[model samples]
Target: MRNKKQRIAAMCAVLAKNPNKLYSLNYFQEMFSAAKSSISEDAAVIKQAFEDVGIGRIETVAGAHGGIRYIPSMPQAARVLLLKELTEKMTDTSRILPGGYMYIADLFCTPYYVDGMAQIMAEWFVGARADFIVTVETKGIPLAMSVARILNLPLAIARRESKLTDGSVFSINYLSGSSRRLQTMSLSKRMIREGTRALVIDDFIAGGGTVKAICDMLGEFMIEVVGIAAAIVNRYPQKKRISGYRAIFELEELSETKIEISAC
Candidate 1:
């Protein structure tokens, strides 16, 4: 039989690996071959450890169907540190492209960066009462998927164009916030149900055109946008087509020879 220390360590592994998932006390009791009282104590210990370390949140749901769930969260200090590091890296002049755009594809593709970004973004919307996550196609999918996993919510993608594989889709035309050119975005009709709440996640927002288009499309399905989040937002244009969105970093300037970014 495993000792108390062994049982607790095993439980921590399970909980940390499956954040936002619930595990009943009875389930733990059987798994650890311990009594309900002992499992309860073990859970309490784990919760305190997580809180003290500021790694995440361990919540105990009350009720017959209740269980324990680990919610991924970052301490304020850690959030600041991560954002600061990212800002420094992004501001490197070499990252600025000819079109006055900063290249961040590598950052989004890296698991370490994406995971940290997702944790921070997930913490912001943990209480948003969102039924699922939404994002436009291409660059935003990776970050969106990570956030959805952390939130334990489904993800719905809006594509730039409809594909036959998508079957019947709901399409709409909206002006690109930055380019001022009309663009069409579509989603599969069966991707989401009506009257549900959605949280939009995107890799970058400029003029908020893409985000606004997504919001307008979701509106067609009667899905309420609970919140919006992005990895970066351009500081130029001063105003965006959409409002109430949060971003991790703000791009203050982007030129061929220099780049300036700051944490938001």
Candidate 2:
């Protein structure tokens, strides 16, 4: 049997996973079959626990759209510490490519590091009050999923072509990476509700062209862009930052060899 404190902690964690939804006390009560007063008191305990941890916050909103929201409140000290750690890992030449770009794929998929990156990005987004996560197909999905899990929200993928997403809607073409070939991408317009709050992300950024196209479509839905992030970035490709967005890695061409990296 779960103790009251344990139950409370679990409840808070659930709400923390997804702070945007309206979770009624009735819902909790029914799940636990506890009284309303007991559930409310448990919530209080959970609230205090979050405060002590100092990563994020929980707030209760009332009526229709009313529910608790977990706001990640990272102090400057924490951000500095995290950045220091991330930079240290980034500095290792072993992770660097001969082409000048740091090959941090191993680091990105690492349990601990990806969790750290997710927290750093989550804290940043929660602070900015972002609501949705957006990304293109393939590599970006996993990272986006991590962020969405922390935020407890849904992710929108701009597909390369019409997938079996059901009820096909629309498609767009944009230059992919450094290639001259125009590639088609898609999204079920119905899948996206109006006024979505998007925080765009990618696995690699060589130019702002793809990001811009994604943003342009988001504009049609009147969504607000929270920010942007990338696992790696090739800075010299376009020599232009997509004004108002921030990238995580600044890539350089170090060495290009056809060395077969060991498969995971």
Candidate 3:
């Protein structure tokens, strides 16, 4: 038989893996062969520990549909520290491409970094309770998918070109604010339901043209954009097409000889 401390650790692990899910006390009582009161006490211990660490929180809902659920969180200090580390890594001059853009493919390809970034973004909009995560296809898919997994929500991708694979699609054309050219973005009609809340996520934001275009397209479907998050935000143009977005890193300076980055 597992001891009280062992049981509590196991329960915390289960709750962490399935965040935002409710589990009845009776279910855990049976699972651990303990009384309801004993299980509740164990939960209290775990909750205090979670609060102390600042890594996350455990919410106990009351009443019939109530149970304990784990909510991921990060301290402000920890968030700033992680962003600073990422900024240092991005200072490599070799990452500067032909254009002013810095090569960030390595950051996206690394699962450890992606997971950390996704946690930060998820924490930023946890209160929104978004129904869906929206992003442009390809590059933004990984980051969007990560947030979707954390929130246990569906992901909707806006494609560069409409395809037969997505039957009965909706398309929109808008000018790329940065490139000063027109572009088309598409999404399947069936993928997004009407009047649902969505969180917009992407790997990078430059002039906010793509994100603004996506928000406009979602408007046609009566979807609400609760928030926008990006891994990197370029500092050029000074003003962006979209407002109220969060980013982990902001590009401060970029040149042939050196690159500068800062936490955003």
Q: Which candidate leads the pack in lDDT?
A: 1
Cα lDDT of model 3 by residue, 50-165, tens digit: 88988688888899988888887777787777777788789978788887667888888677677779888998888998999999988778888888877778899999998999
TM-score of each: 0.96, 0.74, 0.93
Better TM-score candidate (2, 3):
3
RMSD of each: 1.2, 5.2, 1.8
lDDT of 2 by residue, 1-90 (tens): 267977787787778666445588778888887887898787677778778877566677777655556665555676577666666666
**What tens-digit string does per-residue lDDT give for candidate 1 at 51-99?**
8989887899999999999997788798888888888888877787777
Candidate 3, number of clashes: 0
Misplaced by over 4 Å in model 3 are: 75-77
Score each candidate by Cα lDDT.
0.89, 0.69, 0.87
Q: Candidate 2 versus the native: TM-score?
A: 0.74
* Model 3 TM-score relative to the real fold: 0.93
Error of 3 at 201 (Å): 0.8
